[model samples]
Structures are given as C-alpha cells and as structure tokens.
Target: MKSINGKVIWITGASSGIGEALAYELDKKNCKLILSSRKEELLQQVKNNCSHPKNVRILPLDVTNFEAMPQKGREAISFFGHVDVLINNAGISQRSLIMETDFEVYQKLMDVDYLGTVAVTKAILPHFVERKSGHIATVSSLMGMFSSPYRSGYCGAKHALHGFFDSLRMEHEKDGIAVTMVLPGFIATDVAKNALKGDGSAQNKDDDATKNGMPVSELAQKLIKAIEKKKMESYIGRKEILAIYIKRFFPKLLHKIILKSQVR
Candidate 1:
C-alpha cells in the first residue's frame, strides 16, 4: 500500500463538506495539505481547524475559471515544491427535471463538474509525467454510474469524468501515475442545499436522502483508505452503492427500484 504520510496533497473544494472533512483527516495522518476553493475565508477556517495548521496552505481557486487552472496548478505545486496527490472534489449538483432545467444550468454543470476537473488534471499532469509519480483521486457520485430523477445533468457530468479519467489512466500507466474514481452514494453534507435548480438557482434547502446520508467523517476515512490502496474505483456509501452492480447485471430492475425509491 502507498503511504500518504509526509506527502503534499492538494484538494479543491476545501471550503466545506467532504473536502473540509478530508483536510482534518489527512492532517491527522501527517500529510501536508494545500486546500483550495473560491471561498478563501472558509478555507482559512478549515485550515485553522486542522491539528497541524502549520502544514496546511489555503489556495483559493474557482474551478470554473478554466483558463486560470494552469497557473493555479503551478501555484499548488509550489506550495511544498510538488504535490503528491490531487483530490478533485470541487463540484456542484443538480436538483431539477431535465425539461424544467435551463440550458445554462447544464452548461454550468459541465463546466464545473466535467471540464473543470479535466482542466485541473491537465494542468498538473505534466509535473506528474516528469516526476513519474502522482495520484489523481476524484469525487464522483454514484449518479455517475446510473440514472436518477432530477439529477440528469449531474449524472451526465460525472459519467464524463469516468470516461476521461479512465483514458488518462490507460495512457499514463507506464508513467507511474495513479487514478482513482471515488463514487459516493450519498453523505450528509450541503450538496443538496447548494444544488442548482431548473433556472440555475441554488436549491437552498436540504433533502431527506442527503440529510440522512453517511456522515462526512466516515466517508473521509474510506476515501483515505482507497487512496492508500491505490484503488482504480472505490464506491462509498450505504445501500445506494448496490446500484452500481445492479446497473451492471440488472439494469431494468435497478431502474424500477430507483423510481420506487422516490429519492429526490
């Protein structure tokens, strides 16, 4: 197993939720952290909460600003001279039916969830290639592997990540680069509250499924374990994770079950 202790890790979306939890967890493991998000103030808060605050650096980044990612990547690498791992956790969710959703909402979802990740990965890829070592771990939802009502855009964006990252792994395996796709079923966080509506507005309210999802701390532990083991794909969640297998062998039944669940 790969050891992350003493490794410099960069995490986008570090202002809250899974990213914030990861900062605390990794700090406990003696990992150097570079935390990024559009919310610099919140990133500072997360940094201060860490046990080894001195080892954490806050780098504010807006993932949707595609053109700025290369510079951001350079800055991230400069934090401790090199980044050993990049956790692509910056993403937004959708909470509207496809018909009701505006075109811009879909565009925003693609920009933030799919292309933004591609941009950042491309930014740091050269460094990884040159050093012949690196790990790319992304937080993709279970929705990426199957269909769900009101999450059409989210599913599409996440699915695209799998395709792109899978190809990256294949093309760069000889370079000693590692790729891990983290498929989370659900975790108690503000994802639903921050999800976009049909008109590209934040939902601003929590849903039942999300409110009762796995705790963020538990997910963080599992995520670290997946990274340490260098897993190509790790599904973390409750019963919702079964959807991946069901979608593979019993697609029709999975569809019926999803519909019956009525999880918004």
Candidate 2:
C-alpha cells in the first residue's frame, strides 16, 4: 500500500468541490498539502479550514495556462522540498449537446481537461523521477467509461484522460512512479451550475442528478482510501458505479437506460 501520511501532495482545483473535500480529509491524516486554484483568497480559506492550516500551502494557479505549469511545479517543490502526489483535479464540466455546442467549447474542454493536466504531469515528472517515488492520481468521471446525453465534450475529455494516464502508468511504473484514476458519479458540487453550454456559457443551474448526488466529503474519504491502497483504478459514488460493468457486459441495455436518464 502507498501511504499518504506525511506525504507532500499538490492538488489542483483545491479551492472548491472534490479538491476542497480531499484537502479537509487528508489534513486529518497528517498529510502535507499544497492547494492550487485560480483564486488565491479561496485557497487561503480552505487552508484555514484544514486541521493543520500551517501544513497547507496555497499556490494559486490556472491549469488552463500550460506554459506556467513548470514554474508552478518548481514553486511547489521549493515549498515542500518534494511532492509525493500530484492530483490533477482541476477541470471543467459540460452540459451541452454535440451539435449545438460551439467549437470553442470543445476546444476549451480539451484545453483545460486534457492538455492542462498533461502539462502539469510533464512539469512534475522530473521531481518524481529524481526522487524515484510519486503518485499521479486523477479525478475522471463515470462518463469516461459510459456515455450519456448532454455530456459529449466532458466525456471526451475524461476518456482522453483514461488513455493518457493509462499509458503514463505503463511507461512510468518502471520509474517507481504510480498512477491511480478515479471515476466518480454525481457528488453534490457546483460543477453542474458552472458547466458550459453549447454557447460556451454557464448552465447556471443544477440538474436533478447533481442536486441529489452524494455528499463530496464522503467521496473524498473513499478516494483517499483507494489512493492508500494504490489501486490502479477506482470508482466512487452511488448505483452509477454499476454502469461501468453494465456498459461492458450489457451495452445495449446500458444504452437504453442512459437514454432515459435525466443526466442533463
């Protein structure tokens, strides 16, 4: 098992949602954390709420800016001496139809969700390689495995993550680096309200699925457990987890049910 206790972890999207929840959970376990987000003030607030505020350092960063990742990664290493885990959790969701979605919306999705993550991983690769120890964990979605309506762009990005990280895990395992992919079902967060529409505008409203999703804090706890176990891939959430199996074994049936779902 790969224990995170006392490990230096750098988490993107740490200002809100799952990242924020993960911070609070990991803080209780005595893990040193570096929280990154576009908002410095919000990151500071999350740090304050953690068990050991002093142990949490805020590194404000926008993942979409690939060019800045190297400097940011250096800043993180300088702050903690070394980072044991890099959690690529900073991403956006989409609630737009494929045809109606603007080209720029898809571009933005790929930019932030796929390219941004890969950039940060490349930036931190040197640190982990030199140390011969590190973990790369990503927060993908169940949509990465199974498709649904109004999430074409989001699903595409998540699927890209699966491909990219799976290859990363394969190539880097020999380097003593590990990778874990997390697929989560709906957890109560503002992702829906903040989701982009076909016009590249915010949906600005939560859907029924998101409104009734599980609490984020619980998801964070389970995520940490999976990381501790060093599971190559893990799923967290409600009955939606069954979809992965269903999609693989009963594709037609899964398609029928997903069509009936109000995921949008």
Q: For candidate 2, lDDT tens digit of each residue in 122-239?
A: 9899989898888999999998898888989999999999999999898889888989999999899999999999999998999887878999999999988888899999999998
Question: Which is the leading candidate under TM-score?
Answer: 1
lDDT of each: 0.94, 0.91
TM-scores for the candidates: 0.99, 0.98
lDDT per residue as tens, model 1, 110-173: 9999999999899999999999999999999998889799999999999999999999999999
Kindly report which residue pairs in candidate 1 clash with one another: none
